[model samples]
Target: MITTPEHDERMAKMTFASVYPHYLTKVEKKGRSKEELHQVIEWLTGFDDKKLQDLINEKATFETFFQQARLHPNANLITGVICGYRIEDIETPLTRQVRYLDKLVDELAKGRKMEKIIRGQ
Candidate 1:
């Protein structure tokens, strides 16, 4: 088990851009389109393609990435277990946000329809 400060420190140093390609690869390998991935991200963060690209180019850390993000009102609708931690049970704000993205991607890779993943069915 990790402590909050430890998790926060790690997230603060982790760059979203460095791992974003892996997310793209994961979904693409599952036959999901990159457009779909972008759509979900936009829905969650309120950052359209251009803004997202700008953030990626800036090499934003997970904290910085979410700090600038206007999280969707329905984001609370996204709930489930990811990597052994229940999304709602996550104690750290930044870590919860990261896991939210992870859970969404996991849903996509599982072949769930976009509507359900985005709207939380």
Candidate 2:
């Protein structure tokens, strides 16, 4: 089981740009388009395509990346187990937000419908 500190350190060291290609690869491997991935991310994080690109270009860390995000009102609707920890149970707000994005991407990669993933129902 991953401890909070371990999760925090890992997230702190991760750059959104560095992880972007991997997200694309995960979704694309399942025949999902990058546009679709972006759409889900945009719906959840409130970052449009150009702004997301700018953030990616800046090589923002997961902490900085999420700090800039204007999370959707429906974001709290996203709650479930992701990587063993319940998304709603993560104690650190920043860490929880990071895991929320990770969980959303994982759901998308697992072939979940976009609307449900975004709406969380």
Local distance difference test values of all predictions, in order: 0.87, 0.85
Q: What is the TM-score (0 to 1) of candidate 2?
A: 0.89
lDDT of 2 by residue, 1-121 (tens): 2356887888877999998898899999998999989988898788999999998889999888888898888888888898788888777777788878888889899999887888952
Candidate 2, run of 10 with poorest lDDT? 1-10
TM-score of each: 0.92, 0.89
Tell me model 1's lDDT, rounded to 2 decimals: 0.87
Q: Total clashes, candidate 1?
A: 0
| Model 2, runs deviating above 4 Å | 1-3
